[model samples]
Target: MPVHRRPPLPGVQRLARALALTAAATGVIHLGVAPAAATPADPPDRADVKAQVDQLYDEAEQASEKYNAAQEQQKRLQREAGILLTQVAAGQDDLNRLRADLGAVVAAQYRAQGLDPTLRLMLDNDPASYLAGARSLGQATARQNETLRDLRERQRRLDQRRQETAAKLDELEQARHRLAAAKDEVRTRLARARQLLGDLTAAERDRLAYDDDARAARGADRFDLGNEPPASDRAAAALNAAVSKIGSSYVYGSTGPSTFDCSGLMYWAWRQAGVTLPRTSQGQASAGRRVSLAEARPGDLVIFFKDRHHVGMYAGGGVVVHAPHPGARVRYESVSAMPVNSVVRV
Candidate 1:
């Protein structure tokens, strides 16, 4: 049948297209080929990033202190071992001399055919002379016995020294391993911190740095250090030394004219004052007499954190000069900015 149908209207064509799109979507759903739903996610904000970065920096500082402690211990062990080695060498020389003396005495006796002194005296033509010679021989024998005893004692001491040196070497090796491990940990933590910071936008990183500086500045401005005398001349010298390094970079495990860590700053500053503070914050914590924070004076060590892994020099008033952390320079901040562990007057 030749039937001519009218062409569909534009509205009908639009409706037909809509229907086709709906059928296709239905078919996709029925075939389990619909797009997956997007799960909700809350991205980390700037504050969250800052907190994480700070935590990582703190951990890195802790590991850096451990590395410092291990290095110091290794140095001490090496020094002690060297002293022991010197002593052992000297002892060995003495022992050898003693043995030589003993050997000479034995050879003299062997040449005499191991004869009894009284028998030898009886066989000699000049009995009186023989008696005198016998007495001298007896004295020599007594001296040899004493030398033997001395040799035994010296040998014992040399052995002890060797044992001590061996122990020190073992400890030195352990310290080296610990130093390596701490160094690895510090690197790991710092890398993590860098990665976290890297994830942020450049503007966010700038804002973070700006905020940190602003906070430090505000703290410094708020604390007015009155004109108070230092606890001692050494204290004043140390404070001045620390102040001289105000903008030095905070390099982990560095103690110096250029860069420093938390405890490193204290160590170097005190050294400038003719005092040697301990190399680690924990060690420095007990390096001097403890005092109340109220009695804390310039150059006094202000230990922070429950672990005592951080330290700073009191810069009068409530401010402290310290190498704060990685990526920060040595600067002044309020002592109350961190949890105070104790105050040490070194």
Candidate 2:
């Protein structure tokens, strides 16, 4: 009971106490200190947001045209590959038959070997049979050689077709990817526009819509709708048909009696008039006679923008009926709304 442990060194005890206090102070600093305030970014104004949305929409249209072109190319490649595959299958069947025929000839020749000519003649019931066998021996040898050559050639052709098919398959996959990417871009841009609208008050949204409608109405009233008729009966019919679908919805890749895109509307309207237009605006742009805007008549295709991604049917006067874009119905608008690239008469 009298023996006690020696006390720690005074300096060591002081250092230990000091460390504990330092740690406690550090903990207090950590727990009490607030995080630094983050810098807040300014929200985009309505005009800036609208401008971005419009630019995105334009870019999306360009991408969509590229996607459509890729789709057309993919379809062509698929059809060509199908034809090549069919040809290759037929060639394979021919090659197989030729091989079987050559094998039969070899078997017959083997059976004929080591037999006397007189005995060979006696083995056959008819003299014609013996003569035919003799003739076949010579002909089969030549035919077998020819058949082998043909087989080799056919095989080579088949191989080439298979390679082409593989290449086409690869291209088709690439086209599909591109189409998906274009669709995504369009969807993303539209979604962002919607979000921007959501951020605005209901009154602001209504005002924006009202402004757009008023602007369009004012522009429509100012357009000089000439009393001149279409260039031809078909052109007149096409104009009437396009005008009838004034309220139809815009749908990408649709060439229909109902929903339509810019080029699809042209295609459908022209088809109604017994004229056939190409599947895309770019293709249709070059399908007919080029005409100046001064010479543009009703039913003439009014291609727009320097890229020529949009198309509309010229209505009488200075107006054009078109499926403007997604979320917009087919309607009459001034051609001056977009840069006039060219006019074409189909």
Candidate 3:
């Protein structure tokens, strides 16, 4: 049979030849890797992973701070609750005593046998004397009524205090429960690594555990923000900025005009005072000067641990300003929440 000619588009035939020639030089497999149709470069992917990892670290940092803040808030509420409850109890006691006294006075004078009217009237023979005796009786009645009114007022105050105490107690209990639940989640994750080792044989398990311990020991040398704050070109200003931020509400993941996440606030605060800081807590920790809290001053950075995380700025008066984390706003807290790990001078 004679060959039949087939029509080719203008550039099709040339393109086919070019691809074949290119494929022959490189491998046929690599022909699929056009300049446009290529996998992302390691740098870009790495940047993404790093970004994600940074975010995770930031999240963990925030969670830890939140746990600590909720802890502090709960304690404060509880303490106040206790004090209010005590006040309520005291008020009630006072009210009871007053009521008892009033009852005794009334019993003695207002009973059927009280106020010997016949004798009293007999003693008042003249009109002037009777009028004076009548005035005295009216005054006595008025005093008793006033005493009753005062006792009722105390009782009302006592009731109000009790209600306030109860409400605050409820809030404290709820916050405590929330913090406990968060801690439990952290505990569960920590245990997950150990559980993974269970699949190993006895000797293997022992070996893995040993390796794990060694790794942990090495990890201990890792940077802890617990040390002194990083020495800054403008240390005084950084400290002042942080101190000034106290009483602010804690905001998780915020760097703040209005709110701040734990690390975010640290980052932003320092920036405001003409200093630059790392975007993540770990990075910030690595950059500061480590000092003992006893030597701490108003501008020092205070760091804590529940795993070598959570940092704050000392605001003097035993209080610190920190972003606290999720479910909180940038605010002040007592340094007692976590024995400060280290104070940084930055």
Candidate 4:
């Protein structure tokens, strides 16, 4: 059966439709905003990442040089301490011998106590014989006094050597502490750099490598290393040795035929040339006669930064070959690539 009902108003129907549409739109907006809110922030660009990584590597290199300096100092102190120990032992033996000799002289005098020199002189039948015996007694007294003086001098010298050894040991301990701290700093910085690099996408890392290669290429193309002779035969040899290590990986504090740090590379190269440079960049800065950048020749050490924590061997014509930093290989770059601190002719 059909029942009669009042008809709904057009405005009421339209209002109901509008409310339904509004609810659907709200749901759609919420669904769209949820994913947008969950998305992560964009990663840093290659240039920014490279700059940060470079800075970290630079800091790590500085710490590595400090570590090297401390290690060298520790080795020197150990050697010096060893020598001092030997000297002290020898001096002690000499003192003991001298004391034994003095004890023997005292014992002989005690055994002969009953024979006083004055009494013997009075009792002797020949006055000349008594006078000769008195002269012999005087000579014995002089020898005992000389032995005492020698013993005292040796004891003083032994004390001095002991003090020197103690000082050296103290210095060595301090150097060890410094070495540990520097090593930790280098590791921390390097770890941070690695983490940053790891955060980068594979494509981003590849791009960075490409950029580095391109930059190196550009630097090489611009720098003209003419056939300028090295300052000396040794210099030429050192330069050749450094150049031969191109593509070898850089490792913090390494001074080797395979891996090297900035100063380590210089040290190793100079060693190959029959010269020994200092183990740290700061030390190497003063290792030889200082020269102007314009006077720089092949095998000359080019120091970088005011702190002088970085070093490279000059390859002439405003180019240098260096171990750069960790995660990098030995390569040639323009001398002006970093701030030039000084030039040293070794």
Highest lDDT model number: 1
Segments in model 4 whose C-alpha atoms lie over 4 Å from true places: 1-41, 115-131, 210-223
TM-score of every model versus the real structure: 0.82, 0.78, 0.44, 0.82
lDDT of 4 by residue, 1-346 (tens): 0001212321354466667766777887888853223334446555556666787787898898889989999999899999999999999988888899899999987786578767877788998976876688689989999989888988998999999999989998999999999999999998988888888899999887776655434544567888789999999999999988877888987898899988888999999999988789999999999999988889899888888888898998888988888778788887777888999998
lDDT of all predictions: 0.83, 0.75, 0.59, 0.82
| Per-residue lDDT of model 1, residues 1-346, tens digit only | 0001212321344456667777777888999997455435434456666666777788899899999999999899899989999999999998998898899889997887478777887788999988777778789889988988888999998999999989889988999999999999999999988988897889999998886665444544667877788899999999999988877788999998898998999999999989988899999999999999999888899999888989999998888989988877788887887889999998
Model 2 over residues 299-336: C-alpha lDDT tens digits? 89988877789888898788888877765567788777
Q: Tell me the lDDT of model 3 at 173.
A: 83
Worst 10 residues of 2 by lDDT: 1-10
Query: Residue 327 error for model 1, in Å?
Result: 1.1
Clashing pairs in 1: none
TM-score of 2: 0.78
Off by over 4 Å in 3: 1-59, 111-131, 193-346
Please give the lDDT score for candidate 4. Answer: 0.82
The residue ranges of model 1 lying beyond 4 angstroms of the native Cα positions read 1-44, 114-123, 212-222
What is the per-residue lDDT of model 3 for residues 106-209, given as tens digits with 9 covering 90 to 100?
78666633546666666656857766766886787799899988988887888888889889988988998888875665444334423433433567656534
The residue-level lDDT of candidate 1 at 44 comes to 43
